[model samples]
Target chain A: MKLIENWFSERYSDNLQLSFRVSDQLLSVKTDFQRIDVFETYDFGKLLSIDGTVQLTEKDEFVYHDMITRMPFYYADKIPEKALIIGGGDGGAAGELLKLGLKSIINVEIDGQVVEVCRKHFPKLTASFNDPKVKLIVDDGIKYARNTKEKFDIIIVDSTDPVGPAEDLFNEEFYSNVSRILNDGGVVVTQSGSPFYQPRGIELANKGMRKSFPHVASYVAFIPTYPSGFWSFTMAKKSQIKLRTENVEKGEYFNLEIAKSSFALPEFAKKLTL
Target chain B: MKLIENWFSERYSDNLQLSFRVSDQLLSVKTDFQRIDVFETYDFGKLLSIDGTVQLTEKDEFVYHDMITRMPFYYADKIPEKALIIGGGDGGAAGELLKLGLKSIINVEIDGQVVEVCRKHFPKLTASFNDPKVKLIVDDGIKYARNTKEKFDIIIVDSTDPVGPAEDLFNEEFYSNVSRILNDGGVVVTQSGSPFYQPRGIELANKGMRKSFPHVASYVAFIPTYPSGFWSFTMAKKSQIKLRTENVEKGEYFNLEIAKSSFALPEFAKKLTL
Candidate 1:
């Protein structure tokens, strides 16, 4: 086979590549922090790529946003009022929090270019930035966590894979700072890579989270554009978390049944971290 | 991007393609029914393609085979003595059933080349075909269901996407024949395509199954090699199917927790076929 077209391919792993038919490459920029590229695809609609990796697609951003934010929210005993998001430059995690009527959400993102690109191209995610409660700050999340005296009821780390610019977010020192910055009974959730393809990432994150919190659990969700379509999240809190049984406003993906089911790991996944 | 090597690409949809880095093309045969191609890949091990679509891979076949066979078996009231598999020429579903102490199993495959190919290239999936209780029959599943007077306690329709050679298996008449050949309290499960990508297929299969059985439900499983990471299955039973809570022998991908969790559909999936 010969290549006659410009295809946007994300090399998910050494052997796997997920490619979308590109109608146009909307923007390409090499920021001081990382490379950012945005494209208009035929099926996935608009796509935002950071450092040759898919950040989020217009079609299925809800799956990632809903699972990462709402799962922690569902486990928390009380509805969160003040929250903090780390490295979600695409604004997905913050956007989900804004919908839940959080009083204040401080999104500390290191890459201003990612936020700028998403604001210009992806409205569904960046629209929350205009809300009064969401404060977008361009700073290192680890530095912010270490320096700030402010406390939060919920802390969400939406960083990229545990490599390059986002690598520090997965270490024990950062998690200890995150623990310091949270109020009593506060909860924290971080994106753990796919348990199937990236077991080492999940294990490292789980090991780091277990250092600071008494209770820690991991969950899985399906995001098609992601590698292996199986994504995991590691969460830690002071108290035991129960499934949210109440009926709330639902999105394209999340619900109470899925909330509980997301934590049910397969035997293969359960053995990954151990 | 430029392609410098031989890449085995499966066009999942009109606008998306899943490609694997191909190290070698082991076999390529144009059988009487469909094209069968096998390749050795970098990460996914050996790959099997039928009619240009992925049939199974050495790494993740357990996820698909275990969910399809185990779920129905879990719901059946009694221990299944006899079982029948339709269109699973790779011997995956039969392989799972053979693990149980079932009395007998008959696998009806439309194409013999798939069995021959899988038996040679993918031993993990085809090893159960040699079991004394397992019988392989080369014939159309619909014709076999219509002609055979023998009834089964469990019937598994492990066909491909409801197109081309497997098109007839999705119709109402075929489901009616399946209901006829099942014993009282018998359970049936079929692969409905990804609810996100192929809603029409899920809807049609759900509609057909609703015609024959009193209880019908759809569940999801994640298989990265599929078009979408999320895949759906439609199951119908004579009585209310309760979640299996008892401890049972577990597989790498299937356990009581995953068996119950698989039925919890996301909101988008809930609306896909409804």
Candidate 2:
């Protein structure tokens, strides 16, 4: 008798890959836009992958959610009251913003199957979908950004890689539309890809955002489950980027010191944004 | 006909691993202390591994060498003159120190085979071995630290993990011995493994260094080839750690802002040192 080992691997390129041993795969579905996968691993707990890329793991989701939501909230000029999240079907981004005393949150995700899968497989991340202050809309985020007349104090672009359905989200026309819908002193943040492996992700986002906003900068966070474990985020506003609050207390990864220090990039990464 | 693909992997644990596709195996030797292997990788260029763990790659070696050398050199009370390196058989650390105008450097490595292998495959890193200012000693670093009478301004422990032959290097007795051979106002730094996967590595180094020095702190750098892409280094001295110089210009990763921002830790990692 022979024992076969079960493993799931994400290939970043033809030459590099990361693998995890798994006991079972709980969910696999082909959505209208992309493929979504959920696995129960021995080390990283429940793992979620979209289009064959690791999106989040139960063990390290806090790092991504905390960084994406808290960095711009603390950097805003005032306490933001209303937010619009694009492409965050898992409800993690909305869940984090609910703790910031927001009056309303509207999450616009393109794929309805992604939300259905998360609601069944990942209960913790999707609990915010049921909140009274939260509104979930199943529609194309690009079209919604161009058509929405409702103004928001904060806009979060929580899309996947800048390919397939999310490619248009990193361009100038989408940002120009996004700029018109934001209220005064509004801030917009998006997740740029890994600076080590995908430098073009930051470069493209920075180039597009610079055309629409005066203050545009990129910062990095450590996400062990990502392609290189080094991830980046780009934030922009009409006003200067500065800390407006030191009272951000609901995060495992964000503090006032990190809010300031994360913007200091290494030389190699600095060249990418320029 | 069947075609076979060649690859190399580092098993960080039974459940997690990182793999790199190799075009050729340059060198593979079992030394008296550990196994040393060199490969020509497609994505990361030349790769070096000790005991099946990635020590360095040509593409990202600057990040590790810069953080290990320049962080302490800039944070010192004065410009470092004399230096001691433990287990840097590849001579990369010594090469970086030579650019800082050090008077002399003594590198004590336990495995002499690692030096010979690197001298042939990695010429860029081992070019400093032929310099008159460097003296390479093939001996146990544990015994050398316990018995050396030579006083130095800076000591760098570039050893492997805190297990196997390098187990004793992370204890109080070894640090007390290291304290005896340092000049007044001297600094010592060591590589403490990933804070995400191995928090004990930073905890142990912090506990040991606190017993022998007045000021000790740990900072992190991003090394994508390593297990978690996040790596840490702990530094200690008899005096306060203030910037003594802003003239560090030999690295691609070390800038003035990084020298200060790297010390700011996320909340989870901050608890590991305490």
Candidate 3:
């Protein structure tokens, strides 16, 4: 309880000082959503969805969920028989992965509070957790991947940005661990970084991926609410990893055309191949 | 004069009450470097380099301009020696087109305020205008296009969204006239709305493109700063188009690979095709 008590006394805001709160933070801005109570934090930043400030936007929810879930699933060219979700404490990624016809999944999340908050406020996002196919592990992703003996067909590092508990997710050791824990045909997809401002982040991520896997490539999609307005390029192994789409499943925003174009990085992106 | 007053008085934000000033009948939002102005009456927006926000981002600027200018320049491959750019105001398109080895160009911009602003604030964006190859036309695009009798190899519509005076740019008559004034094998490339949000708008635009040219294909690009995260789409006739590039232009971004990738549209976009 002291952990919560020590971090809860202060708040930070842009020079505007619009009364931001940080109680055991759960940092919530007093905006159009919640005029009051804020909840806890995971490493990267405050999960603002359950309380206020940023809600699951109609387009945002659909875009991120579909892109993150569908890209690697299809690219792997196989229905994920077994899966592991790292740092998705809020359970959204697990929810998406569950629908991919996976046999079972273990979600390794470091923050118990984020899991609890997501299970409660973001019902639609966390809905897939109720499925018996998913098992929650309230543990650090890096340690879990390093310690686990089980090799997964698919590993989704659906963590926050490269700052907090998720910082290690951006490191070489973690990616290498992912490669080690994946089966020969298995593919691991991690959100690299926004292609705009964080070109270097993606460059380093691509570098990390290149070191760990035989074939590595980046995938992109538009997310308006995100800063710099683009999402991280998802990297996957190239051999036998052709994203299969025999049935041509229909979705609101995604399809094979978008899939191909999303992976087709610009020349600037291609130049960053090194 | 009446149009100027009209643009100034009716300027307003989408949801928030942001005071968008109209200087000389064009919307001007003063920033650190230049003015982010909207010529609403013309149904297009202009970001004038009047003050602080003006930047010479060649790699970034070419991302939009070259595609807008040169893509169509190539599509109208036969004898597109002469061209007209309406509402580019920034000279970015004019600059890129000059690289095409076009014989002559007339940049017909209605807002002289923007030209002056760009010369002062956005030297890089406008500096390319000094090329003897380009003749600046400071008048309304609709009127200039309507009055011009000489046919052009290409007409690149580089205006803002379709809600301003450029709103008429979307009208069928504009296409008929553009077709009439276009020399055989002439092609026009107009910027389009995000096919993500405005599928209907893109469909309508494509319908008009087909109305004007016998051949029309939709193309896209990943412009991180524009609304809806991506910006820039093109409609062109492929009959005379020859996009196979031999020169590996010594640039940071635009290259042959991106040139081809730029024309590939997603499934969300495919639905909008005429």
Candidate 4:
């Protein structure tokens, strides 16, 4: 007797890959921008992939969303009232931002299909789309960042890796445009890729953000579903970026100590920012 | 066209696995203790596997070795003179300890074949084995810890996962014996498995060590090749554990900030200690 096996793998490089045994492919769609796929896995729960890369898993999405959103929110000088989330079509970032009592959140995603698909399959992440404060816009984030007339207290570039549609988001011009649309003392944070597997992600984001903002810092979080299980995020602010309070509420992966310690990068990763 | 591909994968669970494409299988041996295999990989350099789990990879071994050895050494009240390493057959732990100007290091490994194989495939890690201050003891580490009269300034439990040959190492009896064989103000550090994948590793170590030591704390480091790319370590000391200095010479993954921040556990991981 022969047994049939099904697996979904994301190849980090020619030599390294991570595989998850899947029970079924829940959804596969070819959007105008990229292909989005979701799978039902035995261990990681629901798995989401974009362009053959692991974006988030049901079991570990809290780590990514919590770090990406809460780190900058708490570090900002003031409680941000208005937030602009670029490329967060899945609504996870917007959901996290909403908890902070923001007056408004504008999530500009390039692909409408991603938002539609996520709304169908990822109810928890996409639930924020229906919130009165969250305004979902299916448009190019780069264009929106460049042309927006409104000012924001916080801008989160929750984009994919600096490739394909999100390539422009990591350049100096995009950050300069983003800086122009920010209120005084505003903070902007971008999701840099894994420093271990893709050092250029942080390097490019850091180099670009440094050109636009007075102070920029890079921090990391452990997202087991992502490449190498280590992921990076870069924050740029008009003022200093420091811990605002020790009483910040803790999430699954976020706490007062982690907020401070996440910036303590390994030597190899620290060198990438320089 | 016909294409051939070779890959070595370690299944962490029925649903999850990590695979590395190998250029060649350098060696495969079965000793009295376990099966040892070595492979030359494309990205990770040489890979070493014992009992089908990644023990070390040339690319990321520094993260594991540095955290396991240096954190406790730096946190110790005084400079550690004598070090006892249990089950670190790869010699990486001893190599790091030697850098701290230790008086002597006794490495008790159950399987001598792991040492012999590593010496041939990974000369850099095993180079410290021949150092005058280092003694190679081919014996059961648990037995040695239970019966030995020697006391150490730092005892590092560098064993594999708490299973098979290392099962007894995580019990209260072993930690009690380890505490007895430590000099005043001595510290014992054990490599807890990934808290995300195996919470029991840290739980057991923390439970057992608390029985004997006045202070017990668990910390974590990012090891990409490990099961979840996140790993935990537990340290037990007779006195309070605090940062000793700020000028610890930086390793690839160890720095003064890391020395302090490694103790900041994620909320989920922190709950495991309770």
Candidate 5:
């Protein structure tokens, strides 16, 4: 597992699965399918396929980088002045936030190894490292959120799934802190888990966000590499902000209409919030 | 692989790496990240997984089933007195046509294995098997379409990806035959490939459908099981027929609003059609 780590990849989400492939190995992984027997070839900030299908190439990262960043930006009412990213040690989130031309941005990540890994393997992704507007802090996101004395225009939870160190990110306390650190009219968005298979997690996260903010909604996009392809994201607003999707639309993946439409929920999904 | 295939599992797709686990594998796959070897199983239907990074599942038949049967029935403006389902070996498309209460329906499927497989592995999915209104014609859909004397109100092409024997299903000759067999105001809908992954396929299928019908429109839906979760279907009307989604309202998946929106294409996809 030590052979491959920081290969660049882009991810495209459909309503079915999240697929990741390595350009070097030509190894691809889709929902229910993988090129078997992968070994880690390096310690770069990405997952690579050596003997099986764990390649994190540029294309795979492309989808995530575009989606988590671009989707929310489209809906943001204004070009953000300040931003905070929780997790995202790989700096992809910070990289995307920097593109927003924010006045200031802080990336709070738990794993210093992950940060160093990003610095080495994904230089293009972490190019925002030296940017004047960005700060990289080696701290758990929840702790940072709880202690933050400053407010931000947008909060992006680019954390890993709620396991291991990230489990705390899923708890209600973290959500409360997230709300506390937001400026007035601030909006927060995170990738909530799957809707097709483990709907409960998404529902639970949605509930947590609901308690933290007056306006909370879950919308979905399809990431083929994920288990069920139907991946969801939950958004919380400090105010009843009409989703801020406006004409700043230069995103390759997201647009104004998609930004609005994505917030519309299906009944089975709506049942979760109830 | 043999050891893991025995485990029954469900996969959930979130924007994070895909999650998979045993159905009662005690701990279901979670975005929370603690589980090791999170996606290790590969049911024959769940084709692939990579150290639980990317999880793919059995191809879902629901999105295709709902679109093909309903689109034509809604567009025909006449009760479907007779219907034909080409290559709907899974029975999902057949089941949808049954919902329209057609007097008689024929499903021409070349592969008995596909039908048998769906009945065994996806029984509730193949529930249309027992319906008396449906006649299972175990033959090549193309051959049947070429020879059948009976005029049909609607015909649905529910074939596989165009890589194998299903290749001919997208050509002009087959659509020409379909046009000859349809009664006045008759219509057709065929599953085009994922516009996100296979944009050219959708465009070609739409082009073929257009040659046979005066009115042709393409609609898309997010299906997590397909390559991109965004699957498109081409609907062609034989005559100037009042169309769009019927007045039918869906409780969860589809509705008039989404129907209109699904037809809205991304510029890349639109450029393909042009």
Candidate 6:
């Protein structure tokens, strides 16, 4: 491991910054899209950042990956066979989809550098990228979702924050395209930021989701690496979503009970949905 | 506001630190028991730290207070009248207890400095301390619980982490004393640490609670100022605990739905309790 003495800090907001004592800088690359940096930290194991924002940490990536991939599957009436992942360059979401035994997954990632670097540094996150079921595609997710003739049983917009390249993906038009490309009874799940720190972000995602689907709701999963740790995911379905699948898999964070319970929001979170 | 260029950072672990930009240092007191420092933060409003650990921030204090006081009330067969609060020197728990319209509340705090400082700095948290229902007692919480002659309908252990003066509160002996002084169908709720970063802390709390009461379980509430933002509370009772009281109070984080759902832990959290 390459060693360094300087600490790596991510400014979560104008007032809050989270600092990690780094043991080594594993890789740094500046692509046309965004800057990617991977570091080996003393306590959190590995860290990934894009444009100075923490994308995932090895210690807590499983919590995000498990919730994003497994929560929607539990609500589906039929077993999911095909999934389309948008902007999950880290491959964490793709790896989780592979666990569902899906026949195929079209992972559209805009930043190839993110995937290439994470593949080298975070093997655990990219473990299933080499699986035959996952088809990695380097393209703009909104464009692909709009133009693709193929319909997906499940569509996961595992994009970054609503800024830069991922900004378009958080709009009504993108959600409308997502609705068009989804099979009957298909569900779309997108990571909405923390309600505590970014309540407006969740409100925007909820408004966009409601515009495209009859049934829309936000679910919460606590991720320590993310801002506020109280992260949310907005789910939109053609029909009202309910738990239909039983224990298809046992995970460290997601289970049948959690799938149903995660949707129950605290009063402040409920206000954001309103 | 007394502006400072320097940041106030709390070291979460050997390698992790959370820093906040401060507008002013409102109070800094080295009490005989613990060091209490209150600051006006740029984003989180007011922040309170004890022994160099963040106890609460104005932006998220309601989430912690609402969950701690309201969760156990749902498990009680009757409206909690005589409630006991230990180590909630900040007065956040006492404020919440007053909302229940309790007949009497005995708040035993070891550190008077924490209470006096917070009362002056954080009026929102300490608003109800002067209410006729609350009785503030300055003493050791463990000794107070063990030696009190009066029985309580609810006993809330809102102590600090399992260290220094608060270490004895995490043991089975303290929980046994809590059981002895509780009315029938009473509940003992203690602030278990975050399940993400401090799983062992929660496990130990659960073990101790189980040793004293037949029905013991842990619930979760996301408090952004805490270590992982994902915090847990361990509850023990003489018998099975379920939804008995309804609509006692509405809060920013606590509700009937949240009370029922918070008990449904993520798979990893469930493993911690196991």
In terms of DockQ, the best-performing candidate is 4
* Candidate 1 CAPRI assessment class: high
Which lDDT value does model 4 have at A83?
Answer: 95
TM per prediction: 0.96, 0.98, 0.79, 0.98, 0.75, 0.96
Per-residue lDDT of model 5, residues B137-248, tens digit only? 8888988989989889898888765655677889889999999998878888788887766776788787787787788877767665455556778877767756545456
Error of 6 at B196 (Å): 1.8
TM-score of chain B of each: 0.95, 0.97, 0.75, 0.98, 0.78, 0.95
Which digits, one per residue and each the tens of the lDDT, describe model 3 over residues B152-227? Answer: 8888887766664566776677877777777777778888866764565567667776766677777776554344
Between candidates 1 and 3, which one is better according to TM-score? 1
Tens-place lDDT digits, model 2, residues A126-198: 9999999999999998899899899988999999989889989999999999899887688899999999999
DockQ of each: 0.80, 0.79, 0.24, 0.89, 0.19, 0.85
The digit string of per-residue lDDT tens for model 1 on A33-134 reads 888999999898899898998889999888999988888787777777999999998888888898888899999999898899998998778898998889
**Higher-lDDT candidate among 1 and 2?**
2
lDDT of each: 0.87, 0.90, 0.63, 0.92, 0.63, 0.87
lDDT, model 1, position A151: 93
Stretches off by above 4 angstroms in model 5 are A1-56, A241-248, A264-267, B1-60, B71-82, B112-130, B143-153, B179-187, B196-200, B213-217, B221-230, B238-261, B264-274
Error of 2 at A249 (Å): 1.3
For candidate 6, what is the interface RMSD?
A: 1.0
Interface RMSD after interface superposition, model 2: 1.2
| Quality class of the docking in candidate 2, CAPRI style | medium
lDDT of 1 at B201: 74
lDDT of 3 by residue, A1-274 (tens): 2543222211111100011123354334343312333444322133344322332333355667677777777777566688888876667778777766788889887767666666665667677778899999887889999999998888888766665456678778888888889877777888766666566667777777777888887777766445444676556563655868776564545776776667666666666656
Predicted candidate 4 versus true structure: per-residue lDDT over A169-233, tens digit per residue: 99999999999998777889999999999999999999999998989999998888898888999
> Which residue pairs of candidate 2 clash?
none
First chain TM-score, candidate 2 = 0.98
lDDT of 2 by residue, B1-274 (tens): 5666889999978999999999889998987788999999999999999999999999999999999988878877888899999999999999999988888999998999989999999988899889999999999998998898899899999989888998788999999999999777788999999999989889999999999999999998889999889998999998898876556573687787788889888888888999
